[model samples]
Target: MSEEDTALKAIEQVVAAVQRTQREKDAEGFLALFHPDALWTTAHGKVLIGFDAIADFTRSVLPGASWDGEVTYDVVHTQFLRPDVAAVKVRQLYTDAEGRPESEGAPLYVMTRGGDGRWLLTACQNTQVRAA
Candidate 1:
């Protein structure tokens, strides 16, 4: 595979891992996808800095999140600023208990390939998608 293909594959794997972890409400597993200095903005507009802060917030909310339906995260697009950095757009969907669409989120993830060649989320924002 080409270098770009390899990078995209790695990034996709990271995104997939995050989606699985989140769906399972596995806080530790989700946190592992982030870089130590990661920054995260919640769908509700809360800004969290650093892994510790993200962990604190995630641990407190993820397990207790009041949602009846399933949650899904999918990569919508990707733009590479450099060989080692990519900006990924993700679509987050929530369904009701009956599997009806409840809401959606548009998340932007800035991922960086570490020296170890692992793609890690360095910065991210989860924004709710509301009808205008």
Candidate 2:
């Protein structure tokens, strides 16, 4: 595969892992995708400035998250800032227990490839779609 294609595939896998971890409610698995210095702003507007903050939040919220829905993540768009960095737009959906759409989100994830060429979530902002 070409360089761009390879990078895209790797990024897609990272997003897939996000979806899977969320679906499984595996907090540690979800946290594993982040960079050590990651920044995460939740849909609720709470800002997590580092891996520790993110980890604490994820552990507290993910495992026993009081949601009657399942969440999914899809890569909607990607912009390469450099060969090692990318801005990824993700479509996030929550499906209720009855399988109906519960809510939606537009999240942006800034991902970067480390020295090991492994893609990690660096900076992320998640916004929920709300009615006007």
Q: Report lDDT (CA) for all predictions.
A: 0.92, 0.95
Candidate 1 lDDT (Cα, 0 to 1): 0.92
lDDT by residue (tens digit), candidate 1, 7-126: 988988998898888888899999999999999999999999999999999999888767887888888999999999999999989999999989999999999999999999999999
Clashing pairs in 2: none
- Cα deviation at 94, candidate 1, in Å, is 0.6
Q: Tens-digit lDDT track for model 2 on 81-131?
A: 999999999999999998899899999999999999999999999999996
Q: Each model's TM-score, in the order given? A: 0.95, 0.95
User: Lowest summed lDDT over 10 consecutive residues: which window, candidate 2?
Assistant: 63-72
RMSD of each: 1.0, 1.0
Native-to-model Cα distance after best TM-score fit, residue 93 in candidate 1, in Å: 0.5
Q: Which residue window of length 10 is worst by lDDT in model 1?
A: 64-73
